[model samples]
Target: MNTYQHDWHTSEGYDGGLHHCRKCKRSHQGPRLEAHDCPVSDAEHHAVAWLGHAGLYRTRFDAVRNFEQSVTPVSVDELFELASKQILSQINEGCQRG
Candidate 1:
């Protein structure tokens, strides 16, 4: 495992903008980043780790906020389907390249 220091970046806004890591995609919902543990490596983990809800911390910070604020109707089933399809596409592409 390769532990990495967080490179925290803040969004441009006045409302105590979010601070998120550019590497592991961990996010904090405030202007200041508090202490937290990031993933040890950049390697991908099991899909179960982030295959369900859109609120997963691994998601981009801005995406989470936008999703929360949007009134559009989105179902978890659809999210899962979209995510799975993308994942399968990536895997197939990688396999073909290899």
Candidate 2:
């Protein structure tokens, strides 16, 4: 079920858009693409980098709490890794299909 887009947006994994940063704790502002809105540093353009982290943590936590009650639940870190892999795979698959 093409869960790539749903997973990424729902989990908030570095989609190259402004989000709620845990460090700076700012969302989007001013223009749409301008990094200056939440520009904390050249590397960290957004103030909401922690949003994805928080999302992944929550997603994984919920997965464990709901599905893996009888088994070992995936850790937050593991969820991030899984999201990354799934996204990359989806991108590559898209490229190939296109």
Candidate 3:
């Protein structure tokens, strides 16, 4: 497990405006940063970890771990679909209320 420290990254040499965070991949509007100046969400970290932990051809099938059977394998496209559904539903609800 790699622990991220604030001092590890800082954009000290370049003129800063908006730099995409290398850690979270979010566009952060701030001074040029060598280290990521944006806050990382637990969900984002977990997602990245899960994606990196699995490969395209390999799936986790270990049975010795706790709650292994409860895990479901989902593709990145599927995740986008789920988020799109949630967002559309919220938009619809807002539209109906007005």
Candidate 4:
């Protein structure tokens, strides 16, 4: 199977347009943060597993580190779900403040 490799950093400063959340259909505003490289791929494939909004990491090691620090022994899918909710809550709070 052929795999596509992406350099996520290249798009960091560029306004590639807004991203819409598939589950919530909420418009994710502003310039998106670049996905960190996957440590498993040695920084080749920027594999992004959605968490809350989106967690960007440069490596699998970093992703694991984040999960370890932020969450308990949950599966990736569960972690992502939790993270997504966390992000959405933060955003909602910010909107309320504004």
Candidate 2 structure quality by residue, lDDT tens digits, 1-98: 11111111112434554445443445543233323333233222221122242343233345455544322235456557778998999999999999
Better of 2 and 4 by TM-score: 2
The total of clashing pairs for model 1 equals 0
What candidate 4 gets wrong by more than 4 Å, as runs, is 1-72
Put down candidate 4 lDDT per residue, 13-97, tens digits, no spaces.
Answer: 3466555433223343466534432222322222344222135444446666666344122445555786899899999999999
lDDT of 4 at 97: 100
Candidate 3: misplaced stretches above 4 Å? 1-69
Give a tens-digit lDDT track for model 3, residues 1-98: 33342222344435555555554565545564455254643343444112223222223334213324334445566567766988999999999999
Candidate lDDT scores, in order, read 0.56, 0.42, 0.47, 0.45
| Per-residue lDDT of 86 in model 3 | 82
In model 2, where do residues sit more than 4 Å from their true spots? 1-70
Model 1 Cα lDDT, one tens digit per residue, 1-98: 44656668887555787787876777777667554456633333222223224444333344455564422223456568868988999999999999
Which candidate would rank higher by TM-score, 1 or 3?
Answer: 1
What lDDT, from 0 to 1, does candidate 1 have?
0.56
Ranking by TM-score: 1, 3, 2, 4
Give model 1's TM-score versus the native structure. 0.32
